[model samples]
Target: MSGGYDLNLFASPPDCNFLCSVCHGVLKRPVRLPCSHIFCKKCILRWLARQKTCPCCRKEVKRKKMVHVNKLRRTIGRLEVKCKNAEAGCSVTCPLAHRRGHQDSCPFELMACPHEGCTARVLRGALAEHRQHCPHGAQERCPLGCGATLGPVERARHNCYRELREAWSWRQERSRTLVLGLLRRMREVHRTANLVRRQLAQLGGFLEEEDAMLVGAPQGEAEATPEGSMGAEM
Candidate 1:
């Protein structure tokens, strides 16, 4: 991916066979050509794309003629290597395959601040402590949830009373909204109940009229009592 692995990454000098002639670095993902010559897969691919020939022997090459050297790649993976951040005070050494993992979590590796607007690069291990003093980190909201952004100096001068008051005001407004919603839902439920009661009253009147007709009685005698029905209000 990088022409080839940097020579400085290896614990010791790599074998000449493991070196790519094009990049002059340790072979990564080694590939063999029909000319019986080996080079880094990336290096050989780029060479063939331009010249359609092997760089080492100047022999014609076809894209389909390239063969992967899995055995060599495995051997290279097993080779000892130092962390890429070794120069940044990391002293870890492991197999080449493990080098990437180690670098990923290396405490000595330089990292940009997660806080926005920060351009400083600090060691990964020191990032937490750096954030405590970083200017951009001052954007953190007030601990009381007052939504106030304050720097170190501003935080020292912040009024606890004001923060608490703001929190209280927000809670009061939220409670009012919740109460209003509940009242509206209750009113809708009451309205539905009232409509159902009115339908039952109409059905009762229809049954009374049918009963009176069957018995040959006066409609007034069989009429339903208005007081028997419930009111709309709860």
Candidate 2:
């Protein structure tokens, strides 16, 4: 980046009419005095505030009538300018009017250090170096959903928190497995209870039928026994 920062050499020199006589820079907000000599709007205004005379011709004027030169304003706006951070790895060039907007988007521009309590604004290309020494730069979040966060050099502190999280996770998984096993046993018990109730109902129906057959038999046949037959034979 340091090798390619000469933007002025690439751009054509601005015309004399497009330059500000006071600042010697390209015309910015040009204002045409009644004398027909043009100067930057800000330059002429600042000069008139002190004394009512044109900077170029020293012409005295009472009204100090100023008109905006739209044609020249547009011409200056089209002039090209290189990024101010061209030495910081930026190679972008845009119109002069867009310089401010382009500079904001340039990758080489400075950004505030991300570390807590640090307020250093380093260029993007140099941010790595700044972060290397920043206290909070290497911090990482706990992957096990713990609220704790720790940095690389602070590994000893993180180990205590990591072991607790792992232990809690294992206990939760074991409890879940136990609950599933209990549910399966409960389902088997419910099925066995249903089978027992059905078998009891069938046995009760068979017992009732045998009891009815004995009650409906004649009294003589029920009273006859094998003992009467054995005594008659003797």
Candidate 3:
């Protein structure tokens, strides 16, 4: 039981001298067994089912011989007690008899979301339907680049810094690849320019050597022509 209600805690002692032997709490719906030992209505019924003897003195008891202790019930009803969820932060101190009822609806109770990663604390009644549309518990992937794909409930555990680091890593990798490609192209262009310069130098040297050989051949042709004309005239 939630909503600031801790049903496990023993009920406070009532004003009447009567207390249920089984639960040790103030009598609720007190009933008198045939042995004359008074017990809570639920306690006696449960005991009678297992054994037809009163728990107080082991005397024989019958299912039909039980009687209601109306006076004790009224007295217990007036007893005041702390709220069931007092340890859980509920500060209401109400009648002991009304404790169960009051705690079921107490507003100060701390109720957690059943969603896996969500730590949201809400009122008791709001828990059941709160997960139906809880954004954190929705099924989705982390867009922040952590590569986390999970349900909304588990998504609460995602780390923001890790996601940011992953984004930076991707950007760096892409930039590095682009830079390497540009450097490779530049190297290839430099190599091509060097090859072109070397070819131009080799071509210019070959043309200069051909011009020297042609100029020497033209002088030899001029001397041979003069000798042939002088011999014909003789």
Q: Find the candidate with the highest TM-score and give its number.
A: 1
What TM-score does each of the candidates earn?
0.61, 0.51, 0.42
Residue-level lDDT tens digits of model 2 in 56-124: 888884444888898988877787777788677678878877888987767689999877677899887
Candidate 3 lowest-lDDT run of ten: 1-10
lDDT of 1 by residue, 79-102 (tens): 899888888888889999888788
What tens-digit string does per-residue lDDT give for candidate 3 at 1-234? 111112344345343355567876566688888778888788777777899888989998878888998987776666666776778677777766677788678876668876558889987756757777776667655656666677755666777677688989999999999999999999999999999999999999999999999989978999899889999999
Instruction: Please give the lDDT score for candidate 1.
Output: 0.86
Q: lDDT score of model 3?
A: 0.74
Question: How many backbone clashes does every candidate have?
Answer: 0, 0, 4
lDDT of each: 0.86, 0.75, 0.74
Relative to the true structure, candidate 1 has a C-alpha RMSD (angstroms) of 14.7
Local lDDT at 88 for model 1: 80
